[model samples]
Every structure is written in structure tokens, then in C-alpha cells.
Target: MDMEIDLSNLGTVNTMFAALFSKLGVPIKTTISPTVLEEAMNGIVTVRPLPVGTSATGKVDKQCAHFFGVTISEEQAHSGIVVRVTSPAQSKFKLLYFEQEVNGGYGLALQEDSQKTGKVTSAGMYFLHFQVYRMDSTVNALAMAKDPEAAFFKRLEGLQPCEVSALKPGTHIFAVYGDNFFKPASYMIEAMCAKSYEETTERLKEIESKILAKRNDLRQFETEYRKALARFQEVTNRYTQEREAVDDMLRERDNIHCSFTTERTLVNPVGAGCSSSRYTTEHSIPESPENGSLDGRDKSGKKKWFNLNLNRSDKKA
Candidate 1:
């Protein structure tokens, strides 16, 4: 039985076989066409999850493969899907995973051009993990196997969302996972593009206002200081003038004491100048002679001579 098989239509044939074999509980081998092979080799292929027991027989693009040197098989598709990365060298992505959620948790990731928000919705206990990384650096990551909500907010404190949104080709990855042994749990994760600048501007304005207030306080302190210095100078000048006045009064008192000393010295006795006989002669007067008698005549003559001498001494005094 000869049949014409178009190589260009291999993808359709592979899909038909995959469905048929999956229902029959058997494995189907898929052939890779030239176009698909080229796309996968160039790391431009989209990798989707495959049903159990279905196999695509070809080398997958490295961008879609999670672990290096590992084969892309049906078992891997059922377990966990590898994240697609077009340019691993230049692309920025973040991963947030949570497990075993007894309590609800939250996660967020921000980049220059993209933002992600995630939350765990469960009624049971769970474990959480969140991580953020870039091509050159790991920006932030929560502690492994711990409560992701607290770690998410803690890491967020160091990041400025507005500044992150301003970077070019910025990309961020966010995820949240919850595991419940007793009951089923659900999670929601959202990724979106955004540009933020207003928050940054508001922050700058707040800082500037604080700085201005500080500057005003300094200026007020300087003005008060100048006034206080002027008051101190005025008080000092008043004290100085009062001290000078007191000094002048003391000098005048000393001069008056000296004058009294000089006057006392001039009036005090020197040598025999203050004798008793000189004092008596300068102060005493002779009695007048009585009637007319010879003795009276002699007395009268001496009295006249003494009076003449007294008149001359009075003039000399």
C-alpha cells in the first residue's frame, strides 16, 4: 500500500496521532518538520504541555528547556512545565513559588517595564517562596520554604516601583503556589506592564520640604544668636561705665584726704616757736600806774615803754 506523505503537513499528522494514541492508552511518536526544527534550534519555538504517554520525537529549543542536557519528554510535561526564555542572557524574569498553604499569602514583583502580583487562596496551611533575578544580578529573594507574604513586603521596602518602571526593556516574573494536604487550594497571579513617575516625584518633594524646614530653623537660630550677642554687649558696656564712675569718685576722695593732711602740717608747732614765754608776751598786757608818786613815775615810764614795744610787736604779728 503506497501513500503520498506531505512533509509540510507533518504537524497536523502528529497532532492526529497524539490524540488517537492518547485515547488508546499507547504512546505516539511525533516527527519534527524542517520549519519546526529550525524554529526550535533558533530558540523561537513555543513549548506547550503534552498529555501523558505522548512524545514529541525531536530536540526542543534551549529556550523552552528547563534543565540543561535533559531530554524533553512526556513525563516532564505532566510533572512541571519549563518556563520559556527567548534570550536568557539579556532577559529579566522573576519566580515566586509557594507550597502547603494553611494560611493565605501574597507576592509581588516589579521591574522597569513590567509588574506582577500574586496571591494564595486557601483555607489550609501552606509554605511559600518568592524570588527575583536579572541577567546581571539577583535583585531580591525571600527565604526558602518560609512564609512568603512577610518576605515579599520586606524585600519590597528596598525597591522603588516608580524608578523600576523607568528602566528600558524591564521585565519581572511573579508566582505564588500553595499546597494543602487535606483540602484543595487555589492561587491567582497577574503580570502587567506599567510606567510610574508620580510617586518618585512626590518622594523628592517630601525630602526637599524637610530640607527647607531645617534650613529655616538654622536661620532662625542665627537671628536669635545675633540678638543675644548684642544684648550681652550692651550689658557689658553699662557695667564698664559704672566701674569708671566709681573709680573717679575714689580718686577725688584720695585728693581731699591729701589736702587735709597738708593744712594740718602747716598749723602744727615747729622747734621752740610754740614756747610759753612767747605766747604770754604776745597775749598779756601791763596794768596802768596809780596816782602821782615817785614809784608811780618810774612805773609809768616803764609802762609807756612797754606799750610802745607791744604796739610794734602787734604790727609785726
Candidate 2:
């Protein structure tokens, strides 16, 4: 059966085609009958074009794609999405349109074939490959190679405006890739079976709101941490000053005690005889004790006493 798939309107064409193919399985010779072909041709699906100036755009790098259909960052070889379309076996899938905005004037190159190195040029001539895999396939493109099929299937890329005739019916993964050295590129992409522009726009807004909220929370935490650190420092400084003052007082007390001990030693000699030899006084010493007591006498029968006489002159040595 003859069918016309117009992709001129890059915005809405992919959506219409996706809806159409979903109802009509892959047009295989064995399964697609003449009646089904006619029905598909007559039944045209129309999708509303995204409102003017409402198209959503996003950034993609070799590492990740943000706010776009699918993203692969430089750190990763590929990015994927699990897509469930109506006619998985017979659908004619296409990536009708995409727009890219770049930063730092860096060009992006997408690998068209897994075995070959995709070329790069100063001009923004980049290509993207899509690979579709069965949903049940345990092989994860993001994971390390477990087997040859998993490895091979994971690296596979498909042409844009992808032709899905060869894909089998069921849930599948759609993976995108770029050249190994592809720089950070910002672009927007839409797929035949992907969400509508409006839906994507809304989803992006929700994601942005969540990110902003998280940022605010982090800022608040940082402010609180700084304040706490300041308080701790103040306490430490005060404690150090108080401790130093106490140390100073103890040192002064020790010095005073030392000085007092030295003065007392000079004033009263420990073993020197306290006779008129050291100190002289005008008052004469009594020859004997009045009560026959020897309270001030030393063991040698000499009196040991300090005589205080203000009128006495200094004695000769």
C-alpha cells in the first residue's frame, strides 16, 4: 500500500508518525495485510505543534543531557531511555528534527557506526546514533561488558529519523551517542514516540523547581555552619585568655614567696651565734642571770641574745 509520511513540519511530524505507527505494527510482508495498509494510509494522525516560542531546549555533554530528550556525557559512551510504543514490531520510527546550541564554539560529533570513527569538522556537522534493544535484555549499556551480545548491542547506534521496521515488538531501549571527543553541546531533540513538547516543558519546570529548592537548602546549611564555627572560635579565645591570667597569678605568687624567704633568712641567721660580735648596743649585758636561769645561754655557757641599745655605736669586727 502507498503511504505519504511528510516530515516538513519538524515540530509535530514525529508525534503524528509515532501515533500512527503505534496502531500499525511494522509493515512486514507476512503480517501487514492489504486491508491494514489501506486503513493506515487513510487514518492520518495530527499532532498539535508546540506553541510558538514555547519550544524547550536543553544542554547535553559527553557526560549527560539536561532537560533534553536523551543525553550522553563525555564520561559515558551512551545514554538511553526505555520506550514502549504501540507497533514495536512494525512501526516506522523517525527522529524528524533537532536543534543544537553550542558553547565555547566547540563542535559535536556523533558516531554513526560503531566500527568506524565519525569525522569532526569546524562546521557544526554532528551525527547521533540510536540503538533499540529489547526490554527483557539483561544487558545494560551503562554497565561493564558481561557478554559479547550485551556489549555489541549496547554500543549499537541507529540513524536519525530512525527506521524501526527491523525492531521487534515489545519494550525497548533507545540509546544515543556522540564522538569520543565531542565537546559539551546544548541541543533539543524530539522522538516519534517521545513525550509531546508541552509535556516535556512541564516536566522540565518541575525538575528546575526541585533543583532550586535543594540549592536554597544547601545555602542555609552553609550559613548555619559558618555561624557555629564563629561561636566556637570565640569561646576558644576567651578560654585561652582566662587560662593565661590564672597562670600569671600563680607565677607572681611563686616570686613573692621566694623573695619573702630570702629576706627572712637574712634577718635571722640559721647557725650564727647571736652575740655582741655581730650587733653592738650601748646597754651593758648583766654578768649573771637574776633568777639563776639559763634560758638564753648556749651549750658552751655563753649567753646567746640580741641586745637592743639605741645609743650604742657600731662595734669593730
lDDT for each candidate structure:
0.33, 0.32
Query: Which number leads on TM-score?
Result: 2
**lDDT tens readout by residue for model 1, 1-317:** 11322323446566466445434533222222344334433544333332222322222231122111112233332222222212212221222321212232212222121122232211110111111222211133323115453343333233322212121221212222111111222222222111122354355447645654554566566577668979999999999999999988876666555444312333423222222132222445555446455788998799899999999999999
TM-score of candidate 2 versus the correct structure, residues matched by position: 0.24
Residue 46 C-alpha lDDT in model 2: 24
Considering summed lDDT, which 10 consecutive residues are worst modelled in model 1?
A: 121-130
Let me know the TM-score candidate 1 reaches against the reference structure: 0.20
What is the lDDT, from 0 to 100, of the residue 178 in candidate 2? Answer: 22
Q: Write the per-residue lDDT of candidate 2 for residues 61-125, one digit (tens) a residue.
A: 43222212233223222212222211112212211112232321112212111221133111111
Clashing residue pairs in candidate 2 are: 25-90, 26-90, 26-91, 62-73, 62-74, 63-73, 63-74, 64-73, 95-161, 130-158
